[model samples]
Structure formats: C-alpha cells, structure tokens
Target chain A: MSNDIQDLKQPLAKANAGLDSVHVFAPATVANVVCGFDVLGFAVNEPGDEVVMRRTNKPGISISKITGDNGRLPMDPAKNTVSVSVEHYLKSVGRLDVGVDIELHKKMPIGSGLGSSSASTVAGLYAIKTLLGDDSNPAKLLPFAMKGEELACGHGHADNVAPALFGGFVLIRSYEPLDVVRLPHPKDLWCAIVFPDVDVPTREARQIIRNKINMKDAVTQWGNIAGLVSGLFMQDIDLIGRSMQDVLVEPVRSMLIPDFYEMRKMAMDLGAVSFGISGSGPSVFAFTRDEQTARLITGKLKQHLNSIKIGANTYVSTINDAGPRVIG
Target chain B: MSNDIQDLKQPLAKANAGLDSVHVFAPATVANVVCGFDVLGFAVNEPGDEVVMRRTNKPGISISKITGDNGRLPMDPAKNTVSVSVEHYLKSVGRLDVGVDIELHKKMPIGSGLGSSSASTVAGLYAIKTLLGDDSNPAKLLPFAMKGEELACGHGHADNVAPALFGGFVLIRSYEPLDVVRLPHPKDLWCAIVFPDVDVPTREARQIIRNKINMKDAVTQWGNIAGLVSGLFMQDIDLIGRSMQDVLVEPVRSMLIPDFYEMRKMAMDLGAVSFGISGSGPSVFAFTRDEQTARLITGKLKQHLNSIKIGANTYVSTINDAGPRVIG
Candidate 1:
C-alpha cells in the first residue's frame, strides 16, 4: 500500500506544482440505512462540512481556524479527526515533511447522529489530497479516513465515511480487511432526514445494545440485508421498502429517541417507503420513491415535532451520488 | 394468491388437453450456502431425483412406486412429499378432480444434507405443472414445494426448494409473502460435495442450535453474507471464498458430522476455496474456482475418507443453471 502511494506522489506533485491551496466538501451520511446496521450507508446533500487546506513550510500539519462547531470540537491537530487523518495520509506517502494548514467548517450539529465527525474527517482528507497534488484514487484515502473515525469514536467504522467519500449507496462487505462495495443508486430515490433537538452521544447509544441477540432475529436481519441488496440492483421500489425492516438494532436503540415509533408510523402513513433512526438516535431518516413524497413526509414530520413541543430540523434531498467535490 | 392460481386453470387445461404423461428432473440443492443460514441455496447436477406423472381419471393423487429408499419413505400419497406437493398444486388450480399417478426415483441419499426431500418435492410439482399444461411462472410453484418440505421435515422452508426449482443460486428475500430472487452465477464456479456414510436427521441437526446467538457473531455473519452477494455479483472468486465463512450455524452443527474439521482442512489445503457442512450435517461441500480444482479436492476427499475407514460419495459439478426439466 505504501509503495502504491509513493507511485502517485511524483505525478501528483507535478500536477499541483502551481497550486497552493484547495477547498473540498464532504456530505453528511446516513449510516445503518434501516435493515443494514453497521454495514450499510448512503450520502445526502446539505448538513455537510467543508475543509480548506493550504501548503505550509513549517514541516508539520496545523489547524489554523475552526468555525460553526461552537468550540465543541477539538482544535488540537493531533486529537482532531481531520488532522489525524491528514497526519496518517502524510505518513503513508512518506511525505511527513510536506507541511499543511487546514481550516474546518462544521455545518452540521454535533452529537446529532448525522455523522458530524465523519464529515469533517472525509472533508479534511480530501482537501489535503487536493493540496498535495496527489492525484491518487479516492478510495486509497479510505483507510486514512477510517483511522480518523477510530480517533473520534474509539472504534473504526466505515459505513459513514465510505458513503461520504464514495457517494451513492455503500456496503461494508467485510471488516477484517475492510472491503467496501458501492451499490447502484436508484433514480428518483429521495431521503427525508429529521434531526430532533436532542443530544445522544454515539458511545452511549452503542452501549444500549445487548451483547446477544435472538438467533431468529439474526436470520431475519441477514435475509433482509441480502434482500435490500437485491432490491437495489433490481431497482424495485416496493421490494426495497419491504426489505428495509430492522429486526436487530432499531428495536433496542430507538428507545433512546423520543416518540420514535410514533414518528415512524406517521412517516409511513404519509407515503414514506421506510423510516428508521439515522445511525444511533435523535436523527431519523425516511426513504421515499419521489421528491414530492419526500417533501410531504418531511413536512408532516416537522409538524409532528412542533406539535409535540420539540425543536427539530428537516431536509429533503435525493441521494448524493457525487460524494465529496471541490468547491469553486 | 389462491385467486391468482385459479385464474390459470382454464389456460392450463387447454395447454395440457393433449398431454397424458410427463416426466421431470430436479437437481440436488445445497441449502444455507455458508453465510446465509436459512435463506440462500444453489443447485448442482448428478445427484438428483426424477418424478414421472401420468394423468388419471381417478380424481386424486397417488404414489404408485418408490425406488432407492429401502421402504423408509411413505408409500401413501398423503404422506409422501412429492404427492403432497402435487395435491397442493391441484388444489391451488381447482383441479383436484384431475388425478395423477406418480413415481419417485430418489437418486440421492436421504438424510445426507443434500436436499433430498426438496428435490422430490420440486420434481413432482414441475411434473404436475407440465401434465396440466400450467405455464405459470416457476416461482409460483415455490409455496407448494415449501408445503411439501413442511410435510417431509415438519417445518416449512424454501431455501432448498427455491434453488431446486429455479436453478442456479437463489435467495429467499422474504418469508412473509415468500419472495425469491435468483442471483448471478459465475460460470467458472465449481462445487465439490462429499457425503459420508452417515445419517443426520434435519430435525436433530436443528435441535442442536441454541435459540440465541452472540450479537457479534450475528453481525459478522450478516457482513459476510453481504460480502458473498457482492462477490457473486462482481464475479470475484477470492471475495466469494473469503465471504463463505459461517460463524453462526456451522460451529454448532459440525459436531454432528465426523471428521468435519479434518476434512475441511484437507479440502482447503488441496486448493478448495471454502468448505462447510452442506445443510444440516454428514454431507460436506467445498467451493472452488474451477472444475480442475474441484475434481482434485473431490479425489483427495475420497482418499481421505477411505484412509479413515469411512465410506463416502463425492461429486464435482458446476452450478446447475437449468433447473428441473423434462428428460427422455
């Protein structure tokens, strides 16, 4: 892997000889994607983070500025997910001497279960890649971003970072060697995401799950996972909706979110194909066949939250097929 | 669903007006297919069952002859899987008055984890469909075959029967409405199945498993299942091999099969991509990248069994893409 990275350095340096800085954006990702807890995710527009990088002669990476996070995120370059990822990338390419300065713009809420940390990590890594003139394939940077996720959450997971990096629908096919597969995206697919005004720490949400599960439930979950994959490939909306039932994680974790069941029922009644917690809790997502239905579901969800005396934010958008891109 | 079947009767009768008899063959199936415990299966050639059906004026199904079972199987039509399936088919089409004489040739060993009962059920249903001129989709026959499996094994399941009826690799996407999906099959894929001279009742094998599974194990199993499906679609042999790891059922069920570990190690050493118990136990199967490696593994397995003083039957064949069909 290091050798492969080295091969890209010369070409990348030549390509970016005249360039000194670059800016990139990484979209917010919905992890778990209903029936596929810990293994499936997809990207959505809005609620993303942006990062800007500039070449420096200081011989090390530094965080120059941070905004929109209200000081909730760390400013230490070594402790932050973005800078940690950049440090790893630099080490991997044997280019630690290449100094860089990074600016993080966190546009999403912290601890909202909207993959806030993953967005920063992906955007940071992407921005550094652009500044270094490393025309390396985007996927090669996944490991570095995964390392950053590990720094933030204490365990490495790619479900969020993968979609934020590759876009569309992504499956973490295996965890041992970290195999990720990008699945086909269905046209006209829309997502309705609602973030309630609540803070559910990722670690605490993960701890709520028990160590054992019913074998019957496991069989049902796996069947649905395979069915979900098949549905995506066949482009069958009804099948996709049916395959989105969660039998493993949702039943336990949804208890952390208020009115989770009632909200999901309302979404389904309003024509959403499927509804579930975005990742752990607080943030809920629904899939619909068209943008009109998506908007309707979002409107109803917002109304429901308002009637319940809860502050919430909702967004309706199609799947972000173009993961992260340079901002002009 | 019954109405849908009834609608096919008139057209089926017209199509079968001149036909008096029909014979069909259904290939043996490997259920569970490692990673997918009760929802995945595939067909293989050589070890299969044949059913012959003759239109009769008697008004009900009858089992006229049974071969290769040593009288272990029931002779009564109501008790036999094949006749049970035929009876169900006739009832579905509102053609119970159309009597048929049936013959069962069990070419594969019963209780060998080779889907012996499912093969008989599928072949019988296919034969009846042909005699009645029912050109209805083959998938429509799955429910009838699943009923036959319930009669034979005291539980209803479509994992084996689906692939036996549809051919190639199959996934039972959902159990509520019984959705089955045919997966892409790699042309170079080969399966090596070895059946030891031992009996393992499906019910007994199932009883050995606990009701609950470790949540971590379930996660790993589902991840591998997703990986397996991706591998098949991508036609990646190494990925398929890596994804064939089964952490849920095999550890518990392998205890019923003698020398399971030794045999699996030998097969892997001989270049088999993956190896595991075929369905319940006693019969073991290995996957290989090509026919040559499949043959080599089979030969080594046979020799190992002989050396251990255990009689065994081994088969080397590619996936049976053409499911049940008529043969002269």
Candidate 2:
C-alpha cells in the first residue's frame, strides 16, 4: 500500500468495522423548481426516506427489509430503487464481493411528487458508501443513484437525486455528460411544500404535457430560466419570484392537479414569492422570504385543502444544505 | 425651479451650447448568441454605425443627411430607425419642441445580420441624449431604441439593442417590463466576427423560422442558456463554448446563410471556441480565448469565404464594455 493508504488504514479499518451497519437519511426534494423544469431542484427538511445498509457474508447485494412503504415496493434487488442503487455502487467500485443487505424506510408517500424514490435511492447508495469506508467524491455516486431513478420513474433525470445527494439548490446544466452545478443557497429562502392526498403517476403526469411548445412560449421560458439562475446567484428574492413563472410545463401539468390555480393564487396572495407544481405534481411548492411566511402559507394551504375534503400534508423548510446524513 | 431642475440647468446650458452637433458611435452587436435565441446578445468593438445630431430651429425631428448607403434608408424621420429613436427620446424627455437634424452614417452593411439598424438607433438616441444633457440611465433608453428596431425589422426585440446600448453581454430577462440584465464580461474574451457580403433581411430571416419548437429541443436550449450564464459569471470559457450549441434556432435559420455549415466547421477547426450565425445570419461570429486566436480565426474565415467567391469583412474585438459614446 502507498503511504497515504497506510496512514489511512487505521481510520479506514475502524470506519469499516464500526460501520458494519449504517443508516442514512436523505431529504425529500422539490424538482423542476418553477421555471426550471427538468433542470433545477432543492432539498427540503422533512418527508424523506431512510436506508439501512449492513455488511453481510453473502457475496452480493440484497433487500433484507423494507418499511414505511406498506409492501408497495419490490423486495427484488434489481427492481427496487434502493437495492438497485446499492448494486450499481458495488459494481462501480468493483466491490461486488463485498456484500451488502439494504433496508429501506420510505418516510415519504410514493408517487406524491416529493421525490420519494430519489430519496431512497440516494440514502441507500450513501449508506453503503459510508459503511464500506469509501473515500470517493460524493458526486461520483450520482450516476448510480440516477440509475435507481430511471428504474423507478421509467426515465432518467438527476434533478431530484442531485439535490437529495448534495443538498441545497442544484442545477443539472446538461444531461448528456450530467454536469450538475450546485448554486449558493440564500439563508433567508424558505419553501412551503404541500402534498395533497392524491397520487399522480410520473408517467401520466408526463403524458399530459405536449411534445411541442410554441416558439414564443419557449423564448419566455428560457428567458425566465436565465433570470432564475441569475436571481439565485445574486440572491435577489423578488427576481427569483418574478422568474418562477413556468410558461412551458406548468400550464399543461397543473391541469391534472386539483385546485392548483386556487392554491397558487392563495400562496402568492399570502406573500409567497413564487408558486408552482413540484415535479410531476400532486404536490405544489412555493418559495418565501422567511420561515414564518413559509409556515403561514403551508398552514393556510393545508387548511384550504382540508376544508375542500382533499386532505393534505404540508412542510415548511429552509433549504437543507446537508443532504443525506448518518443516523444513530 | 425645483432643486433637481436648478442643478441640471447649468450643465444643460453648457451641453446645448458646447455640443451643438454631437457625433455618437454605437458598436455593432451579435444577437441571440447561440442557445439564447431572441434573448441574449453581446457587443463588439468595430463595424458600427455613427449618427450626428445637431440642434435646429424647426420644432421637429428631421433627417438632414444620409451617407454610406445607396439611398436605401428612408429620409423621413418617422420611417428611419435612427430618427425614430431620436424622436422617441425627445418625446420621452418632453423635448419634442426641441428640434434636431440627424445624419446617419452607416458604417456596417445594411441587413448583414450585424445589428446594423440597432447600432444606428442606439447611436442616434445616445447622441440626442448627450446633446440635450440627459443624464438618465442608459438602460432607460432601451425601449426607444427597441421601437426603432420594431419599425426597421417589423419585429421589436431587445437582444441587440440592450447590448448595443449597455455594451458587453446582455440578457432580456422579461419583455413585459423590459428587464435587461447586463451580464459580467470576461476581460480576456475575444470575438471573431466575419460578415459575408450578402443581405439576409431580418424579416426574411425571421419568417423562415417555425412558430413552434419541439419540447425536447427547448429544454436542451434552456439548459445550455443557464450553462452559458453560469459560465460567463464564473469565467469558464469552455463551459461557455460547450453551452453555445443552438439546437432550436440554428437548425431553422441557418438554412438562410450560404455555406454556413462549412464556415462554422472551418472556424471551429481553427481554434474558435464557439462558432454560429450572428444575429439573423449573413454575419457569423465566434468566441476565442485570446486576441491571437481571434485574429487567426477571423483570417481563416475570411479566406474560406473568399475561396467560395463570397467577399467578407472580418473583425477581431474584445467585448465592448463601453457602449454608445460621443466622438469628435
């Protein structure tokens, strides 16, 4: 071994031994953060997924246990997001001989547009990486996790996985080579996320969107995308709010979400900087200047949804800068 | 007199008397800047238009003299881009009663897709603004110049005018309120501009483009636009070059520019960082790392165009950060 490896041998041994079993919590993400469909996303504090990884004598990855999902997820390692990601990770590091058994605790609702699968996928890969004492860069694991997403959603996109892995706001600038840029998060920025008690399958949500868009609308959307990036970099809250108008995807997709327009109007009226459908929504997210306003908007949205008999879960979160973390 | 008026009166008197006839030069601009169709542009240092504004006793705007063009431009103030912009500027400042005789000196070829009309419009308004001692923000004058573009091209777009008026790179964030953001310009960034001797009227150039674009292409374009903006702010030249791919506009509009693909290939092979049809085509521009590379690329592009019996004008310039200025 090289001197560097020799020096790290002590800590590496302790890490591998002590971390025979490790649990990681990966936060939920709001993808397609208004005006940045398929490009931008941010991590929220709650409604995430947890994955537990334990070293085993067996020579391959396996799904030992799954919870919080009520058996909705597959136990097959190849089919499950968490196990699939762990499998990919093991294969990537040429550590297939190092066996791992994964347990997924899906704390977030499935197909609710809260990036439930992405959270589990990220947490599983992160847990295995930690347990194995891997010193590789975190971003290198994105592709493995993205594979998990592809298996779950039938399409590969990194907007959710990126933020769920790196935390804060992230921009997937390009997908071919997967260039992800993590933007500086404003401390005062808060998110009001509302998940109504309705499920919109990712495939169905995507199908509603037109394959073509008017050139004029495309120009407007691109301009806003530029403005949104500028706003995030400059930390101009109002500019961000103004740029959150999604002229391309939201109009068509929002039609599938009940009371979307009403909720958006209410949120904006209550001083929410911007409001739009999150991911392939049934969940809607709004950005606010402060935590208090975020809470107020969330409470009001939930109350309105309840009064209308739609039932909802609301979350008030400042951006989670620390993405997945080890838990005792 | 009010305090502001009292303060301005002295300078106004001196400006009117000392600057009876003001000459202003506005640099030509490359609009759309690949990937950012209709919303992005940057200013170059040479091949611009010059306008002279002289105070007259007549209580209206008049086109006193026109040079460089073979009587193609209109003589009537209402019909000419420069005079129209000047008229709007005077009306905006409530100085319609203050008559002016304008002369447009077209240094760049008309309809060469080098923002020829935009330069003339900016120069004229800037001249009048200087002669009348209007110390207003330069950006506030964008609408007047944009109106000039509308009258000239049958479409009002500010991508060209904003950069020409402000100098350097510009993004029109929103059109309703006309939010133009001046992007940070890298000091070492150089442009290799080659204007082939041909006229592609802006109207004809615009007509060939489709009113709708594939959604997939739009996403790619917007993502690259974000990358380009981030690249500019971070001074990542390679990122800028990578993000300069235009899948939406170029595929359609490039059909109008003769030997466009051949010229683009030559420029790229000769160390051009990014090569594309500038503005509406006929004029092609490329970004390079330094002055030497810029000159080399320009010479090769000119030679290649000449070999095809197409005469061309080549310019090597860094981004012009100082926009419209009064010249002796």
Candidate 3:
C-alpha cells in the first residue's frame, strides 16, 4: 500500500484556485440546426448559466457546493459534469497539482434545451482557467469542455459545445479531430426555450432513434441543414423556419414528449421563426425576431404544456454572446 | 389602314436617347453553390458588367444602342435578354413603357462561370428598378432578372439570379413560385475565377445532365447541401469546402470542359479552400482565405489553362457582399 501510494502520487489539483475570486458565464446553445445533426449551434444570452467561483484552501478539486439544482445533482467530482470538466481543463493546461474549490450556481435546468450542461461546462472550465491566470484560449478550452459534454451525452456533438466555448453560432465539421467553426450571429434575435417537467433521459430518447437514417431522409435533412444555416446567416426568418424541419428525429422523439405537436403548432401559429427539439427532447427551443415574440412563444408553450397537465419552465432569452462569465 | 400601321411602328424611337452620364456597377456572381446544385448563388463586386441606362423623351423601352456586347446582343426590346427582363419587371409591377437608353461595359467575359449573364440581367433590372422608384422588394426583383438570364442560358436557374438580386449567398428554394432566401456572406475569404476562353454552351451543358439521379447521390447531395449552407451560415470554411463536392452534375459537366481535372487539382493544391466549376463551366472559381492566395490561385489557373494553350482570363476576388449596385 505504501509503494502503491507513490504510484498514485495524490490526484491532480487546480492551480491558484483559492488565491482569488472568479466569476464565469457560459451561453445557452442550439444543437443540431437541422442537417448539422450533431454539429452546429450558436449561443444566446437571455437565459444562460452563470457561476461565481471563489478559491478556497481546500485540498483538492471539489465542489464547494451547488444551488438551483433542487439538491438533485451529486457533489462527487467524478459524477458531476461541471466538476469533472473543471478538473479536466486544469489538468490539461498544467494547472494541476494545485488545490482549489469550485462553486457552481446552476441558473438553467440540467435538461433544458438552453444547453445547461455546456454552459456549466464552460462556466466551470472558465472559472478554473481564470483562477489559473487564463491558461488557454477559446480553441484550447473547447476540448476540455467537450470531454465534459461527452460524459453527459455519451457521444460528442459540438453544435452546442463550440458555442459554449466561443459564444456564437458554430458549425462542427468533425468530432474525431474536433473541427469546429463559429458562424456569424444574426443581430437582434432572441431564443425562447420551453422545458417541460417530464423527464425523457438523453439515453432513452437517443435509444429510440434509428441508428442509420434512410439515405433519402438524410439528404433531405442535410438540404434543410444547409438551408437553415443559410437562413441564419442571411437572417431570413422564413427560410430559417423552413430549414428547421427534421423528418428524421422530430417525428419519433416528439411522440415521447406530451403535447409536442400542440405546443409546436401554437409556437408556429404565434410567429416562431423556427422551433425544434433541443438536443434529444422533453425540452424545446423556438426562434423569434424580437423580444415580444419570444415572450409570446414562451407563454404559449407554457399554456399548451399546462393544458396537457405538465408543468414547464419557459425562458424567453437572447443569443448568448458572452459564453462564460463568473458571478457569486 | 395599312399605311397607318406601318407608320405607327417602323423601327420605333430609341427608349434611351438623351442623357448618357451615369455610373454603373454590376457584380459577378457564383451560381449553384456546390451542393445546392440547381439553387444557390451570390454576386461579387468587380469583374461585373456595367450598363449605364439613361432617360430620353422617346417612349417605349428601346435601346438607343449598346457597346461591349459586340453587336451580338439583339436590339429589339422583345428579343434582347436585358430588354425583355426590364420589360418583364415593369410589366409585373404595372409600371410600363419607360423610356431609356443603355450602354454595356463588359467587365467579365461572356461565359465565365462567374455568372456573366447574371451581371447583364442584374445591371439592366437594377437600373430599371432604380429609375422606377424601387417599389419591389429584393424577392420580387429576382424573377425579372431570372427571365433575362434565361435569354443568356435559355433557362432560369436561381443560383445566379438570387445572388444578383440580393447581396449575399442565396438559396433558391423552388423556381415555380420563385422562393429565395439570402444567406450570410462569409468574411475574409478570397475567390479566384479563371475563365479559359472555351464555351460550354448552357443549352448543351444542361442536356448533358441525366434527369434521374442515383438516389444515393441525391441523398449525399442534399446532406452536403445542408452542410454547405450551414457551413456558410456558421462561417466554417472547412465545412463549406467539404460540402462543395457534387455527386450529381459536376462530374459529368467537368468532362465536357478540357483539362478540368488538372485545373481542379491545381486549385486545390494551390491552397484553395474550395474550388468548383463556375456554373456551366470552362470557367472555374477557387476560394482562399486571403488576397495573396487568391492571386496565387488565379495565377495557377492561368498557367494551367495556358499550358494546354487554352486562352484564359483570371480575376482574383472575394465573396460579393453587395450583389448588384448602382453607380452614382
């Protein structure tokens, strides 16, 4: 045991974590803008994840505590998505072997389409990066947060991940080497998210999707993907809405979420430029040109979901331009 | 009665007979943005056709005459593409019979894949749109210009028309109803167009394409289309490049153009982020991140085409943010 103790050599730690106070903000994101499937997204600001981290004399990387998760999440670092991402980022940047403590305040729900985990991942990594004197650039910080995302979703999908790191719309070309690009964010647009209280765990929802899509459907999917991306860049609301339709996933997944059709219809009827499942459903997001429409969509979604007897959390927000910032 | 009818029409007075002083700037364009196949394009500044239109007391839309088209373009308003388009634009909006004179300045060659005909169409329609007080929106202007393009190529394809009307990358959804969406313009990217003085008449080129596509290829094409549009929207060069591949028509069409393979290889090898046959080629456009590389590509294309002793014209440029602009 004594010899093995040398082999272990005390787990890696966070550097300069306790030396100062740090705050980080991570943006909410849209994943799978139609044909991008697993690899395109942009950030929104209105409702996002903010963390205020203060360093402590704590012996290792540990969660000082958490709030707003309704005491549902674990405090254990390995089991916690945010804690692990923070630890991973510090270790990769050679900020390891230093003691630190992390305090994450979850502003958005874990399964919300607002990219709750990605925001948290960004916030956690950012908090640690700041505590360590900003050890990495956006490019460098991406993978660390991505690893955290993989832990939560079982596979890496950067549409949401890249935005969480870079704070804009992003296109993920490949996950193997992690090729990602940030797209121009259309000005004056807001994103409205509706998270129903019903839980359709990511694993379960993913399991229902066919492993291989029919090539015909795939092409249509990609066409729409291109169209949607084009629409976003051009700021064409009608085209963006056209490009958001996904015959592949929505048909199957929407069935799992109660009143999905009704709520979606309501949102569209109320002028949502686009609406679709935010990553595997139970939660959804809609695009609006203005704040009034966003609020209207949120209210409509809430009302529809309620009529189905399901409570929902609705946030009418804007694109998250500032990816990760810190607060206490 | 017969004498009165003969006296009434004869050659008709010149529509544009008075002032001859107006600056004009038409933009070169890229029709069919890779995977979009039948429907995507954008106009670029420089290397465009400039046709200055002026007003005259003489009634009816007859050209006082023209330059730069080498007397190849018809003088009859009903027969000329630009004339017909202007006539159509006016008729469609119920603003008919405007008097105008015109001159054409050939900035780009007659058959460069860089949408040479679109330049003429846009210039004429734009001038008319301006002279008519701009009652139509960007969307409405497209059909008029498209009809003009049909004169040059004998068919209306939006990839060229949409961009010519709008300033950025555009998606032509369906031609029947003329649905179009302008996507965002990429930043900091350069484009090099090499027009080998060989003509691949649009009529023959369209015939060369097989009407029925392999479902497999169709699927791939749509997927890439989605990816490509998303790439542009996301501003991901690699994705755009990857998505530029065409499994449908490029292969067959490139065969008709001499040395097409070597030229493509040259463009790719010369650090071009992407390269493709411009419209119905013999002309090709290569893209890069900077002006230096763009020139480098243009030079490579010129040399390659020349080695085979094919006459060529090369233009080093970038994506056109403003499709068709009026010269003040």
What is the two-chain DockQ of model 3?
A: 0.15
* Model 3 error, position B282 (Å): 2.9
TM-score of 1: 0.96
Expressed as tens digits, the lDDT of each residue in B279-305 for candidate 3 is 888778887889998898888778877
Look at candidate 2 and tell me the lDDT of residue A233: 79
Name the candidate, 1 or 2, with the larger DockQ value: 1
| Model 2 regions lying over 4 Å from their true place | A1-18, B1-18
Order of models, best lDDT first: 1, 2, 3
lDDT of 2 at B167: 96
Question: Could you give the TM-score of chain B for each candidate, in order?
Answer: 0.96, 0.93, 0.89
Residue A100 lDDT (model 3): 69
Instruction: Supply fnat for every model shown.
Output: 0.65, 0.72, 0.22
Interface RMSD of each: 1.0, 0.8, 5.3
lDDT of 1 at B30: 95
* Per-residue lDDT of candidate 1, residues B149-266 (tens digit): 9998888998999999999999998888777888886789999999988878999999988898888888889888888887787787888888899988999899888888998998
Candidate 3 lDDT, tens digit per residue, A182-202?
Answer: 666568778888889888887
Indicate whether candidate 2 or candidate 3 has the larger TM-score.
Answer: 2
Task: Sort the candidates on TM-score, descending order.
Answer: 1, 2, 3
